[model samples]
Target: MRILARRISVRRTLLKTGSEQVLGIPKSGRSRAITISPQTASLLRKHQLRQKELRLSLGDAYRDRGFVFAKESGDPIQINNFGQRSFANLIESAGVKKIRFHDLRHTCATLLLAKGVNPKIVQERLGHSDISMTLNRYSHVTPTMQDQAARLLGDALQF
Candidate 1:
């Protein structure tokens, strides 16, 4: 889903849910909007619904932790936490084969290239600071897109 606003607030009675801040800065920053597929959007909506349920279950004892996945004990989510470990374990159990967390990023680029998305658009969605950076990173996966450039030129010339 695209981050429509810089910050979004989620309000709940008797507790302060606070705002979810987008990661970006003004005047040519790296962070930008990324379009999520419809399936992913649905999953995210479901996840949000589950989080609401969790909050309700905890009642007044629920702490207003400003994290998407924070422990009831009020610990901030960290990279080395059980949440990340559990996710890694699930990926391993799925037999995805030797892939690092970083590789998921490359996989997204490859998929976008395979689906014939414009390189520039993909670059924007990925939030590469520059177009050249995106080109350098995914050049190997985007060779076929070169053919489209010739087609575009031909189409333009015919008009």
Candidate 2:
């Protein structure tokens, strides 16, 4: 789970079935590679170093399982427990409405689209099967983006 430049290997299987954490491929049934910002790479590197320190301090007491987000013993954290505790606390502390953890993916897509990143690029990052899916899912964000683009174009022409 090294978050190196251009990529971070989370190393967890990407599927959920009922309550069981069955390890397998993603919903698209294929692997995906996405790039990250240098800032993000730096943050992850820091996190990895901290994790290593914890591992070393714990010695044989550390489980050393490869899951990136894990319990004190290095076992995978249960999603339900994470939601009930960490996610809930985070929402309250941030003064934001409670949202499913999965909603972060939708939020990321919408924010990128609104910022004028190409839909195809967003599709690839989201591991969507096709561009249409990304476009359709985030269509609500497009009108505002279109308006922004028009404003920028008009401003340029006025110069």
Q: Who wins the TM-score comparison?
A: 2
Candidate 1 accuracy as TM-score:
0.62
Tell me the spans in candidate 1 whose CA falls farther than 4 Å from its real position. Answer: 1-31, 69-76, 82-84, 142-159
Q: Which stretches of candidate 2 lie above 4 Å from their native place?
A: 10-20, 149-159
Scanning candidate 2 in windows of ten residues, the lowest lDDT window is 8-17
Report the number of backbone clashes for model 1: 0
Tens-place lDDT digits, model 2, residues 18-137: 866667776677766788998887777777788888899999999986766677777777887788889989998999989977778888888987877888899988888988888887
Q: What is the lDDT of residue 63 in candidate 1?
A: 77
Best by lDDT: 2
Span of 10 residues, lowest total lDDT, candidate 1 = 7-16
